[model samples]
Target: MKPHSLTDRPATLNSRYNRLALVSSPRHLALLNKEDADTLVVICDWLLWQSAVTDGWHCVHFETALIDNHAPDPLDMDIMLRANDWVWLDGVDHTLFHGVSLGRQFCSTAQYIVSAYYRMDLALRKLLSEFSCREVTLYDYWVDRYLVSPDLRHLIVATVARDMGVHFDDQLDPVLPGDPALAAAPSTLGAPPTGWHKLAKQCGLALHGYAMTVMVAVQRRLRPRVNRPLVIANWNMVRSFLQSDPADDCQPMVLAPTLPKTLNLLRRFWSANILPCPYPSVGLTQQEREQIAAMVKVYEAHWSEPAEGLEEAMRRFMRASVLTLDNLLPLARQVKSVQAFLRRYRPSRIVVDGVKSPPLSIFLELGKAQGIPADYIWHSPLAPQNIRFDNLGCESRQEALVERCLSWGKFNDMWLERIGAACSSVRVGNPVLAKYTAMKKSGGGRDVALLLQLVPAFSDVRGLYLSQYEFFVEGVRQLNQLGYKRVIFKMHPSMWREEYYEEIARRFELKVEIRKHGRFEDYVREADLVVGPMVSGAMLEVLASGTPMVAYFLKPSTLDSTYFDGLNVQSDISRLGEAVTNNEFLDPAVVLDLYCDSECGQSPAERFWQALSRSPL
Candidate 1:
């Protein structure tokens, strides 16, 4: 049947019984014929359109079915109706399920329920409830049928609203009135004249500073006055935080920082206002700042730093108010959103972690310009003045530049002087390292393990393939050649669908095991050594266990950009054999003892909290 647009569907209320009857029998196919199939198509189309328009969801037509094979036996028509109502609930993508599952409770219950809706609703509700928020409003139109229902709509709406602690308002009003030129003319009539003039006025900045300073100022401002501040620690930092009493009220919010999308989603749902620390505009350059300021609200001339013509722009156009410790340099594309959040929340402080290079310095300068205090949580201690040669293989030009600039600018001394000059103090800590030490000693049994992470081959700029199946095949072959037996080949978690690893294992006639369940540490403990490209986390964990590590650098060129540079990056598989025979491994005592020492061993969490406590907003 040809696809039909839902906008043309006529509005009419059909009872659940009638709708179910129409869809339940094979004769319903004739109904499509009687109404030119367009009617049914229109109804379906309209329903999808309404849902999408109401909620920020995308829905697409799958296939027309005379009878749902997945429908329950003895066919409870009521349940079928409820299931149908729920098929598009919350605008969740439903392409995964082959067909809808119908049951008896759906029919007689009068509580029109969709299994998919309930599942998603429960999961989302539970996830939101864990966070401290006044309320969460899920605006979507796909559930219009349920919303219009007298019995089920009210109950579901009320239940969801109460659970989320917020009002659930479904605006059925069309985003754009009518259609085409007629609908758009009304909006244009009131639109501002001279777009270029408005654009010019929008892109202006007032102040600039070092990125690190902005981060510190922001962090200082965000220090919780009442309860303990939430410290976000990944699996690697959880144990360390739990062991140390950083402060009486400090709460740990354990989360992996790797998933940017998940973090963005979480940030959207959070209620707390987000404040972005301004940094010196000098690092951003005039053109870059102009581009940024055009989209965001630029706060001007608040602070002065050593950089030329540098300033900060406070963005106020974010969908969610999120106080991100992550750098805003890469997210220049979302400057409007960032500006939105800043404008709405006007957050007092911005907490910044991992500000080691120019980006960090730029953020700090920007925060200072914005008049927002910044607090920095440093993972590694300040590199000594003589340690310039230490970073011999860093591929990032910005990193190299920062090192050179700081050296020329005497930034290390200035930074230390600034640390003492500022109201707050610096913290020396490595939360991940601490967690690894504790987990290894805890005697956690082996379960799932990541054996190897294949590094992609790099060529010219913009030519790196993320997946290197061929390299992985070569690595596996090399491992077998070295008398290594019974090794479990674990592909990166992100590449589960790629079956290349599985196929290669089969072809090699190797008796290697592949794991798919349980804690990754279990595999780490069972295995003797971790062999892969520059996956620092695995190496760090294995080092904590005092297990041997053999890193196979894909190429010397590839290692240039990795953190492994100047830190024993191996180029050949032969190194693995040499390390095993030579009993070469990083000394846990030396590494751990460095952190254990009074100079660098201080708990970072404690130092961070103390700094926050001392900051004058």
Candidate 2:
């Protein structure tokens, strides 16, 4: 059979004609003068646009700037058109102008020509190798615009061309095309593929395809409405989980909530109940209550339940649902609630927030007896934060026991072994990091902000209270020593109680600004650096923003050494000076490795998702 020729092809044959033409915007073309030409060539292949160039086909490369009536006289249209059959190079607004110019230039010359658009620089680099051809032409213009790196641009081009089936002459580069799993592949991060595998086996649990579902369960709470970092992390986990499966039993769900406000947004995505176990006096307003009700309605649609008394409601939800318990209730109450709920729901897993809640003994007993997987959902930094309150009746024994369990060197290993056996821990990134990235790009300025969780240093609450004041004083002193002028301190939402701000000022003898409760990312974005001693998770948020952090570790009496060891805690005050100066210690990849590897387990979100997937209605 004879091969097909361009002349014999139908004027509008869809199979022969390229439906997608990807040209870079004017901004990208300007970058060509600055970037390595070889790199540009490589990018074209990576973008999958190399085939068309090598075939000596008519490919038009246009600059958006030139098409906007910005082309200079004495233009080298021939040099531009040397190899390609057609070329139109324009400046900014070229996308608009190119359409007009193309119509006038090719009006009646060709039988049929469909204009498929792309950016200018992308198109040039894609067709640069075929510059030996003579029929090429160019329209010129110039404009300043930011362009992605040639390497990244190449990958993008290749992906688009691959999807469009137009072979670009560029070699294909590995690109994470909006698939978190491909981005989070073990090879991508240079980590072991079986990292979660080891964790599951250690936990002595079966690998159920529940993690992806659980990710869908709490994706809202874990992510923001716009540009959520946790979404990326969740995507990566979901992709990994799906690929790990040999069968089609589990598929990932993308949770996008159509809510205006942050409060109700979570309900749109998750069926799991989020009991806002705030302090007693922290009452919800009428509007807030109505919003919560609306959210509940949406939540109940997929995971519905009958209304009952508080105890029974907790029991029923715990039994049937994947329980997410915030640590506020007493140890006995918390354990009993979980136990009762588990008996009814027989849930596949549980996530307990707040490190100070239930004792380790209770969790161990529950795990040993019921084979129910459990993990922590930390929301604060691991370092101390300055706060004061009178602990009138809180017990210390439970605190001590919990601290001991967290500190035990073998506890994490054992827990990992147990949990890792059946279900893998999903490594979800912090959502706050995503928020901070947006805030910074907008040029919102707040120099230094501290997120403080206040609690008194009295006998009952002494265990929970570390001397964050000392760390703050030291942090301020160091910042001053390093010649930083302005600093803002954001009090944790819980610290709004009493005169915590006044007390902090009195004790520290420094006029630190007390910021109002708001999105933590705003503070992170505005501030140059974040300082705290005990807010590990919050530090994770800061790290996500690629911000510098100065942490002061005030060793609590009952604190676990293993927890500190796992953290690779940098407690030296001098190190803070170095970190502030170098600004290289706060990379999330480094921090994640330190934290994730500390305990052979998946991320909290990952574990939660795993549980949600296995729980029967």
Candidate 3:
């Protein structure tokens, strides 16, 4: 199937192959046009969306760009809403995989799959709306495979087409050899683990599995002598609950499920007796494995053909799904183990940093089921964003995940009410805010801290033009030009690709210091001014600390920025220096009052611990 040439009439286009060839790279389209393919092209990437405008073939782009003349389609939101609703099968707010509620067992994995599906649906619908024919030709040269698996992609595309009452004549165009110039260019940021890297990962997982098995057995034997409250947290979170005490009595023992090595060091050096709660070493039962095998049929019914036959595609998808499930099995097992732990140990009350984490979420759910009270502390600031509100609303209602929210301040209360997270609230004060307030700013320092966030190229609410690498390199260049003597790059805890950061630094020849460890406030105190993206959670702390900070608003976010209206929110990178130097900031006391509105006499950490101790059963 081929696209009609410019001289060919519309009637000819309707005869055989409809007008579209989906290409992975802009260079691919250039090559196709050079070869006189004369087909209408469709682009899938955000960065490539810009090229479609200038490129010759009247291309249709999936990603909406800043330069797009038309207003965003209202149907885009409708599509998202429909996708969200469809994920919950049979009117149940749960994603089922072979009759098992994957959403209930593994929240993050289900959310990821649903999110990917939604994005794919949006792209397909956007393309179809432009070319509203019942039948269309889609020349598949889309080989940029980093974002999603080919199997899952095929399944999503087929399902969306079926849902929209459309049929596709997929023509498999062989992948063209990449242009050397384009090949070297940074298009996609990350690569999937392969070769020796893959082997090392497998070996590490096996070791962790063995370690978890031993830890679970040891935990059973080392159960607390007397029933007391349990603090489900990491070593750092334990500090918020307990003061520096001489006695390591293991009362309200901390369950640090993440970072066993760190826990070992903390146990040896710290006052608190932090227990390692590794993920349980468990496999699916025979019945469950059979159920997983049945799940392949669902995918088989929906998957579109690639180079392989339908049977081969189904076999590959089945194997992939099973492998994925095997990786996630520990989470399911951990959930069960948590229930058992609650039954046997019978903790009086359970306190968690947040209910979003699997270990903490499981404890929250089980605590409620077993008639035990659970307290939720606001570990980090929750920005009042549209995406977050929808997500919280959906997840909270799906399960009564929250029993009592130990809110940081009035700000948290407002967010809770808005999202309808209908749980009792106690203003326990924010330890993070309290810690920041205690530190005196060492003003007169020449150091500037550039706080980094993990902003991906594609997301449900993403509107950023810059990739993570582009943003960092450009930010450093701007800072370097601004006569900053020493610039410190502070990576977000969640953005743990140190090697990636190092590579970016090396490629750009950036003169900066990288700090991945220690307190965010320590860096804040050391710097004269702090600069970071507006979406960063660290911005809240900077505001609370009354530090001179510039919130870089590169793009529009789903988050309401009315709160930072008076503060420094610079959209233009060129004016960042001006904003930083002038430093006309909001009054620190005002920010503190609004965000950290707690009883002022006691420190937030002390107030938190006291609140936990006196809470009624």
TM-score-based ranking, best first? 3, 1, 2
lDDT of 1 by residue, 335-366 (tens): 33334334533444444443322223333334
lDDT winner, 1 or 3: 3
- In model 3, residue pairs whose N, Cα or C atoms come closer than 3 Å (at least 3 residues apart or on different chains), thus clashing, are none
Candidate 3: C-alpha lDDT: 0.52
For all the candidates, what are their Cα RMSDs to the real structure? 25.2, 28.5, 8.7
lDDT of each: 0.34, 0.33, 0.52
* Candidate 3 lDDT over residue span 27-138, tens digit each: 4565555323335565654335334443444554443322222234322222223223323434553334322234444333333444444444555666566556354344
Error of 1 at 76 (Å): 65
Better candidate by TM-score, 1 or 3: 3
TM-score of 2: 0.34
For model 2, the run of ten residues with the poorest summed lDDT: 388-397
- Backbone-clash count (model 2): 81
Model 1: CA > 4 A from native: 1-348, 353-369, 375-427, 441-450, 456-471, 474-485, 495-497, 515-519, 558-569, 589-599, 615-617
* TM-scores for every predicted model: 0.38, 0.34, 0.67
Residue 320 lDDT in model 3?
A: 64
lDDT, model 1: 0.34
Write the residue-wise lDDT of candidate 2 on 231-253 in tens digits.
11122232322322211121223
Q: How many residue pairs clash in each candidate?
A: 66, 81, 0
